[model samples]
Target: MTSENTIKNQLPDAISARVRSAKLSEGVATLVMDATGLARPQAEALEADLRGALEGAEGVSEVRVAMMADKVKRPIIAVGSGKGGVGKSTLTANLAVSLARAGYKVGVVDADIYGPSQPTLLDPSGQKPKARDKQLIAVDSEFGVKLLSTGHMIEPGKAIAWRGPMTGGALTQMMEADWGDTELLLIDLPPGTGDIQLTMIQKFKPDGAVVVSTPQDLSLIDAARAMDLFRQAHVPIIGLVENMAGYMCPHCGEISDPFGTGGAQAAAGQLEETFLGRIPLAMEIRVSSDTGQPLAAGDTPQGQAFAGIARKVSDWLKAKGSHG
Candidate 1:
């Protein structure tokens, strides 16, 4: 007979009933439970508790858990930028929304340690994520996108002064969070080719990475560095997206090259990869993202740009069979 304390320690926190445990020939342990009619948030909570149960189990190299589901399916993508200020966070938030709009389970990991903007880009002014078993519960942003950001973990007006180990530790927590039924995990990496980026790549083993850049030559050059970094990490480069590529004058019905157009596209060509598309220098995209209602949620020029990029992203993932 199992003592109450032993049972409580072994069982997941939110397990409504007995959990079936099995050990596979490959040494991977499987934990099964029932979660019918449970909401997404509750499922995430259950996942965290179940994962904790197998953390210290003997000879367990990996643990797989299922809750009222026959199989698991989710594709994780990493989005990187050469440097900051190219609207990478905005693009990440919007792109995640667009992918969800296409009926895929989506989540965004704001791994941008230096400047995490997901909290501002996706959630409102006063919202914050609460902790369950010291694990963060990813806030539900609109468009069915769940968001977790480093910015949300800090106090207001405080800077995160972290060394390589600290930053990597924080990132690990965010990546290992209970992302229940997430079909696509989009990681918004910090700009620049730094230790944090490399560490994240090694830890997560993302399926592919999307590089974001502006039309300017310097940004494009930085974007190339990002592409090379991912290649070195053995992660495939999905495609390149040109943000703020140009401006369309609504009043004059003329288009102008604000950041000088086609630089990202040309760079993608040089790298022998697909150039997803370009987003114009539009006010709607800026205002909407800033207001926590990303432009991709509606039919705007920027929204269309994000949709096009999402389609290209979907097609590329499908071609590589990464979506499975």
Candidate 2:
């Protein structure tokens, strides 16, 4: 007879740690294992491994394993800007790629209904997401980030002339998609405080917001309004990112402030928010984005800039998790 104690002791440390309970009776082994934080494939592999480990045990003819995992609430981060042409979408794409590079399962929701550009930035292959059981699946990008965008749903270059309620409905559909095991979602909100923004705030409240702007007075003013929207809705401001802060001449290697410098940092200080970092107005960034290869996927200085910002955001997330 195989005793329960003997069976428990025989489990590998990795397996035993997850085993909440184990029993052997009548030539059968039963196990209750916690699969917390594991994705479906991982949990399935664990089950197979557990069965394999027990199959050869004395007096064990059958193995039954029950896997239980706590439901994980995925955090949503809104990447917003007060006005268009500030590189908010580009920043969102890079941030998602950088976070994915840092071992996070991240997803991007291109909530810019009128101007869905993530498909072009992240999934240049133009692969449309499939639907399963009426739930839209996220399309996988080469950079390890999953994506759901209005660009995928509609034909290429088609203009979206949707009313507030209609656009809001579309936002809801993307937000409630079947994102498997995605721990974080970066929503690239449309520019300005419009219907989509309000729908995002009221329907699926984000855990935090990252406001993007150029380091110019005009852009900073709009960025402030965007920040105020999130503040009014009680969404925490993760920080501010100064995009297009400076331009570097590729040939001459001279640096110049095309949009002026440090305006966003000053604005962040005035608003009592963290200044995440700046992304230079680099042609490399623009080219990489246009080609659907995020610069953050590389290790160049420009890539490192996005990576640095991602590190700060990751640190903030860790701190938030620790507090909870």
Worst 10 residues of 2 by lDDT: 1-10
Output the number of the lDDT-best candidate.
Answer: 2
Write model 1 residue lDDT over 140-192, tens digit each, in one string: 87668998887887886689899889889888888877676676899999899
Q: Candidate 2, clashing residue pairs?
A: none
Query: For model 1, how big is the CA root-mean-square deviation?
Result: 8.8
User: By summed lDDT, which 10 consecutive residues of candidate 1 come out lowest?
Assistant: 1-10
lDDT (CA) for every model shown?
Answer: 0.81, 0.91
Model 2 lDDT tens row, 124-222? 999989887788888889999999998998899889888888888888888888777788999999999988999999989999999999999999999
Pairs that collide in candidate 1 are: none
- TM-scores across all candidates? 0.79, 0.84
Model 2, runs deviating above 4 Å: 1-69, 322-324
Give the CA lDDT, 0 to 100, for residue 323 in model 1: 71
Model 1: lDDT to the true structure: 0.81
